[model samples]
Target chain A: MTETASLRRAARRYRLEFGGAMAAYALTVLGTSLWIDANPGSSARLPVALLPVIPVVLVVVAAVRFFRSQDELLRRRQVEALAFAFVGTALAVITYGFFETVGFPRLSAWWTWGTMAILWCVGTFVSSRRYG
Target chain B: MKNLLRVLRTERGWSQLDLAEQLGVSRQTVNALETERYDPSLPLAMRIARLFERPVESLFFLDEDAT
Candidate 1:
């Protein structure tokens, strides 16, 4: 198969894996939250609360596989984007940490990941435009 | 870096996507190469040279060399 065909196949596989993982994550989160609320004194509360992490791990694996499937140029772009996201998210979170001490609301740890994801998208867009 | 990518590509009437397909890269990567926005890695440069049947040095050079 041509590179384009191979890339398309990889992309299709990635989409499916990512979609499935995200769906599982959502369901696990919903289920676990409901279970915890219904069984506040349950002995398995900690384990049930962490159930969503399994799908999250799968999502990370899917991402790694997708990254490996990319060509060198795309890989470079991804690296650059990830670096941007890493630094941007770190700075934002650290800055917000100081604000919390001054009276800001405490944010969930998930916000850090969400911020990084948004920054990654922004970085990818900027990098794409730079190359174009 | 300066390169003869655009000239050679146009000479053969190949679109960016066509060359990208030949080079196993995205069309945007081809555009980046042609526009001198991004430099290819050594292996990729060699691949391009092999594809065009040209010496690597002949295909790409420092910008100062153009002057």
Candidate 2:
């Protein structure tokens, strides 16, 4: 096979694996949202419940594949994005801590999770803009 | 670093895609490197060297003076 053809093949394989894992996570996380909404009284519906193990497995597999065979550029880009995520998350938590230490109270763990989601999206956008 | 990736790849009758497969990168990434639109990191440089069966310094140069 020609060089170009082979490269396309590799890229297609990586995309399939990465995209499939992402779709699985999305479906599982959104699907389980209902359980939490329906049974607020039960800790069984928490986001980190045992029911979500499937997505975790999918993520782990995808992660292994991506790390083992991904392009150097894309790998570096992912690492940069992750660094941005950590910085963003840490900044949010520090701000929350300061507010609580003063007279201002904060929301519960759910709110923290919600904030994390928001910050993650923003971090991805910002990091991609700056680096990717 | 500047590299003779374009020359060596062409001499071997290898397109950017072929090198991309060996390197596990997109053809676009290979094109980018060849056109000097992007630069490859050390690990990638080493991979290319290994694939081409050339010394790292032979394929990639630190500066114009290295030649």
TM-score for chain B considered on its own, for each of the candidates: 0.97, 0.86
| DockQ (model 1, Cα) | 0.52
lDDT at B47 for candidate 1?
A: 98
User: What lDDT tens digits, residue by residue, belong to model 2 across residues A1-132?
Assistant: 433554455557767876787787787777787767777788665544555677667767866765655566556655666676677777888888898888887777777657766765676676445442
lDDT tens digits, residue span A1-132, model 1:
334766888899999999999999999999999999999889999999999999999999999999998887788888999999999999999999999999999999989989999999999998878777
lDDT of each: 0.92, 0.71
Off by over 4 Å in 1: A1-3
Relative to the true structure, candidate 1 has a C-alpha RMSD (angstroms) of: 2.0
Clashes by residue pair, model 1: none
* Model 1, C-alpha of B9: deviation from truth (Å): 1.9
- Relative to the true structure, candidate 2 reaches a TM of 0.60
**Runs in model 2 with CA error above 4 Å?**
A1-50, A103-105, A108-132, B7-14, B35-47, B50-54, B64-67
Q: A58 in model 1: Cα distance from truth in Å?
A: 1.1
